[model samples]
Target: MAAPAHTFTHDGIAFGGDYNPEQWHPSVWEEDVALMREAGVDLVAINIFGWAAVEPRSGEFTFASLDRVIELLHAAGIRVNLGTGTASPPAWLTLAHPEILPIAEDGTTRYPGGRQAWCPSSPAFRTAALSLVRAVAERFGSHPAVALWHVSNELGCHNALCYCDQSAAAFRRWLRARYNSIDALNAAWGTAFWSQTYSDWDEILPPRAALSARNPGQALDFHRFSSDELLDYYRAEAAVIRDLSDVPVTTNFMVAAHIENMDYWQWAGEMDVVANDHYLDYRLGDPRTELSFAADLSRGLALGSPWLLMEHSTGAVNWQPINFAKSPGQMLRNSLTHVARGADAVCFFQWRASLQGSEKFHSAMLPHAGTDSELWREVVELGAILSKLDEVAGSRVVADIALVFSWESWWAADAESRPSTAIGYLDQVHAVYAAFAALHMTMDVVAPGADLSEYKLVVVPGLHLVRNEEAAIINDWIADGGTALVTFFSGIVDENDRVWAGGYTGPFRDALGVAVEEFAPLAPDSRVSLDSGATGTKWSERMRVTTAEVVDAFADGPAAGSPAITRNRWGSGNAWYLSTLLEPEEYRSLALQLAAEAGVDSPVRVSGDAEGAVEVVRRRGDLASYVFAINHSNTSVQLQVSGTELITGDNNAGHNTAGHNTAGDNTVATVEVPPGAVRIIREESAS
Candidate 1:
C-alpha cells in the first residue's frame, strides 16, 4: 500500500534532466547552472547516484556538496526533483555485510562493480539503503526548491531475480501470504506431480537452476513473488518519503525496450506521477512505432492523467550494440511526440555529458562540443517550444481503441520451450501496434479485465495467461456492442499456469467463435501464402470456425485451405479472430478495416499521400484543444486545421478556403508542415 496520490507540483510542462554536479569540480557547477538557465531548464534532477557521497562512512552525514548544487539552481529560479540517491550502495557497507550481495539464478554471487548489486529481499541492504533515504528526505524535504521526490533510479533494472538463501526465504514468505497454508501452496504449485510434493513450507525453494526443467506453476509463482518483492520495497521507500515530506514522489519506470521485470500495472497506483525513461530501440522493426506504443502505455498507467517523460536521450544512447545519433530534427519530433500522447513534462537522462564514466558516451543536453553543438541548440529550442505551449498542460489524449498488454503474460509466454522461437511476446505486440500506428491511430495500451466499456474497439494479442474473471470482462464487453479483435495463441493458460480445458483459446473461444485444433508454428525463414494474397510468417494455426464468417483462409501451409481470419457476430457487436501473423501492410489493411467497422477514427486524418508519413493527435481540455502534427517524411505535409499555430505563432492566413470562415473562427485551412518539422495548433474549446 502507498499514500494517496498527491499533486504534481511543478509548473506547466516541467522541462529538464538528471544533473550530477559531483562528477565535476565546484568551478564547473556554475557553468552548468548558467547553461541550464539558457536552455529554459526549470526542473532538474540531482544526486541520482549519491549514496557513496552523502554517507561516506556507515553513519556519517555530509550534505555540503549537494546543498551547494541545489543552492545554485534555486538562486537561478530552477526547481529540483530530489533523488534518494540509494541507487548503488557504498563499498564499505557491502564489504562489511557480504551476505547482502545478490546471487544469480545460476547460484553465482554478484559483486558491487555495477549498480543495484544487492538482493531485493536482503534485510541488511534494506536497512542501510533506507537509512540513507531517510537522511536525504529529512534534510531536503522542506526545501522550497524541491517540488518532486524521485525515488531510486530505475528500480529492478539489473538485480530483479535473486536466488540466495535470504531471497528464498522471502519468496516462501510471500507465497505463504498468498496461498495461506502449505496445503494450499502445494495445490497451487501443482507439486503432486514429478515427486515434488511438499509437506512443509520450509521445503519449498526459489526456482533455481534445475537439471531438466523446472515446474511451470512454480516458475510463474516465483515471477509473481519477485514482482511483489520489488513493489514491497518501493512501498517501504514511499512510506518513508510521505512521513517526511509533502512533495509528490515517483520512480522512473523503464517502460521502453528490453526491461520488463516489474509489473507496472501493479506499481502505477503507488506513484503520484507515472514517470518513464525511454530510449529508442533500433533492434525493433521500427523504433518510432514502438515509441508510440510505449508512450501510450505510459499514458495508460497514468490513467489518462498527465504524466512525466522522466528521461530520454538527446541523440543516441551508449548501451545499444550500435549507437546511432538522431537526425537533424529527430530529437524535437521524439520529445513532442511524447507530449502529443499525454506527457505534461519533457526531460532527459542527463543535462550535461559525463567526462569519465560508463555512460559518458550517452547523449546529453550540453554535449562535449559545448554551446556550438547542434544538440545544445536543439535543447534550447525544445525548451522554448514547451514554454510557448504552456496552455497545453493538463490536457489528455483521447483514444477509442484499447490494446491489452501484460508483463506476467510476457514472462509466461516467452519462457523457455514454447511452440516457436521464431516469434516472441513483444514481436506480435509491436507488429499489431505498428499496423494501427501506420494508420495514424492512437490507442490506449490497457491491461486485461480493465473496463472495456469506455472503448469502442479492443485488441488482445499474445495473451498466454489470464484469469477467468479477466476473460469474462472482455466477453461481456464484446456482447454489449464493443468490437474486439483477439489474435492467435492467447488465453491458453490460467493464473496457475494450467491449460484451459476446452481448446487453445480457453475462455475466449466462445466469444471469438473459433477454437484451435493445434498450433502450426513455421520453421526459421519459412513463409506461407494466404488466399487474400497476403504473406504469413513465423506462425500459422490449424483451427475450425464455428458460428463465424471466414474473412481469409490459408491457401498453402501446414493447414492448407483452412480459415485464417474470421468474424463472428456476438450478441450486439462483433468479435474477430486472426490466427496467423500477417505482413506489415496486410496487417494494416485488416486493422484499418476493423477500426472503420468500429467507427473509431483518428483525431485528425492526414492526406492519402502522407498517410504513413505524418501523425496527428489531439489533447483536449474544457477550454481548448491542441492538435499536434508530426511530419516524419522528407516532404512537406499540409493538414486541414483551424487555429493559430503555436510553433510559428501565425494564424491561418492564406491557406484558408474562401467562405469557410463565415462562422467567424480561423477556418479549416491547410497548414504546411516543413519536412521533418512539427506544428501545434491551438483551437477553440470542445463543445
Candidate 2:
C-alpha cells in the first residue's frame, strides 16, 4: 500500500505540538520559535483556534499576523500543519445567523462562547465554513512553510448531535435516502407497534422526548446521521483543500471509546493521514491501558500506515475534574507508549502555556514556571531522545491476534433499553484488550467486518449488534482454520437493533454449538464461582451446549452447573463461547489458552521472578524488530531479551546481565526496568 502524503518532513518524526501564536503578543513569537528550535522541534501545528483573530467581521479576511508567525517558524527550519481556524467561528457570524448555532437535545440553543457550537446541517453554517476553508486553502496552499492542511480541530468533540428543526429536516432527508420508501422505513423501524409510522419524509423528526420509549431504530439512525453530517462538513472542507493544494488534509480524531456518535471507520477513508487527540482520563485507576486502547484503534484506522499523535497533554489538563499532574518521567513514558503502539509522531496540545484563557492551567512544553521548570527540562530531554530514534518511525506493529470492534454495535448496545444497563460495549472491549495486555501479548483492535485472514486468533467481545454479512465473514474465516472467541451479549441484534428470528447468538449459535435461551444479569455486588476456580460477575447468560465441549461450568448460581465456557470444532478450527464475565486472571489464562490453540505466542516473555507488570510490544522494521518494554507498576521488574538498548546506545551481547555486558553475540540478555519506565531495544536479529 502507498503511504499517506505529507506525513513527515526531512525523514524524521514530527516532534512539535500545537502552536497558537495568535494567543500571545508579537514579541513572544520570535522567542517561541527560538525555543522550539532549541528543543529540536521540526513541525508545529498553528492557527488551530484563530478564527476570531483572522477574520473579525463577516466576509473579511486578514492573514498578516499569521503570515508573520508562519514566516518566523519557516525561517527557523520548521514545517507547519496549518489549521483552517473554523473550529470556533467569530461572534459576528453567530450573532448574524442564530440558526447556525446548534440546539441541544434539551431544546436549548448553544451559545458561541464555547467552541464547536455550529450546527453541522445548518445551511448557513456550511456556507460560511466552506467559504472560510476555501479562503484559507487559497492563501496557504503553496506557502513554503505549509506541509499539511488541518481541516478542523477535533471534529464533533462536542455537539455531535443537534435536535434543532434544521437538523431534524436534514435527518429526515438522510432517512429517505437510506430507506428509499416509507413502507420499507416503517418495517425496519417497527413503527406499527407505537403508531409512529410516517407517510411522508417530513413526518419523521429527530429523536426527542415525550414518548414512553424512543424508537431504538430511530435513535440508531439518528446516531449514524449525526456522524455522517459531521463527516460531510469535513469532506466539504477537504474538497476545497484537495482542489487548491497538494498538501495532505486531516482532522484530529477524538477518543475511540466514545466514537458511537461518529463512525471513524467510514470517516478515515476521506482523510490523507490519520491524526488523534487523546487525553488521559484521570478518573480511571489505570489510564495507560486506556491509552493503548486508543492508540491501537488509531493505528487500525490507519491500516498499517504511520499515524500522527496530533495532541496529548504534557502533564495536567484543565478540563478533567481534579486535573491530576504527571509524576516524574511519566510524560516521556506516555508519549513513547503511543510510539510503541505505532504512532510516527508525538506532539502535545500546545507549545506554550496560556496566560489568560480557560486552558491557562493546562500544562504545555513551556509551563507557567518557564524554562527552569522540571516539565520543560523533561520535554527537552524527550525531544533529544526522539531525534536519534528516527528508525522507529514508519514501522508497523506486528501482532498474531486481533480483536473485533464496531461503532454500530456500540451505538445499538448503549441504547436506552437493553438486556441490562450495566452491559457497556466499550467496557467489554477494554476488558478483553486489557486481559491480553496483562499476558504480555500484542493485538490489533480492528473493525468487526475487517479482513481476518491474516490473524490466527480473532476475538469478538460483547458485540450486541451483529449483521448477517459480518457473521458470514467471521464464519468463513473460522472455517478456513481460524480460531475465534465470542463472548456474552454477542449476536443478539442485527444492524437495525432487531434481534434475529431463530434465537440469540444469531448465526453464531451453529458455529459455537450453543444457544442462549435467556439472560441472567446478576444483581450489584453479586458473583458466581466458576469450575475453573475463577469468579464471574456483572452478567451471565443461560446457555445450552449442543455439540461443543464444555470448558467450564458455573459452580453456583441460578444457572449452576451450566456451561460457562464451551469450545466447538467447526470446519478446520474451533469457536469458543464465553457465557459469563470471567475474572481478570481467568480471562487472561483462557485467552492465552485459545491463542496457544491457534499457534500464537508472545514475542517477549519475563524470566525468573518478576513482581510487577511489564508490558511488551514489538514493532517490525525492515532491518530489525523494536521491542518496547514498559513497566506499569510501582516496583522494578527484570526482563530477559536480546537486543541493543536504543535509549542508552548500548549494544549488549546475548545472555548478559543488566548494564553489565557490551558484546552483541549472545542470544539472550537481561535488563532491569525501573518503575514507571520504558525501554526500547533494537533486536540484533531481524524479525
Best by lDDT: 1
Model 1: which residue pairs collide? Answer: none
Cα displacement (angstroms), candidate 2, residue 436, comes to: 0.4
The digit string of per-residue lDDT tens for model 1 on 414-452 reads 877689988988988999988888887889998877888
- Residue 4 of model 2: what lDDT? 53
lDDT of 2 at 45: 92
* Deviating ranges (above 4 Å) for candidate 1: 1-3, 653-668, 685-687
Model 1: lowest-lDDT 10 consecutive positions: 653-662
Candidate 2, overall lDDT?
0.84
RMSD of each: 2.4, 2.7
Which regions of candidate 2 are displaced past 4 Å?
1-10, 608-612, 653-655, 658-667
* C-alpha RMSD of candidate 2: 2.7
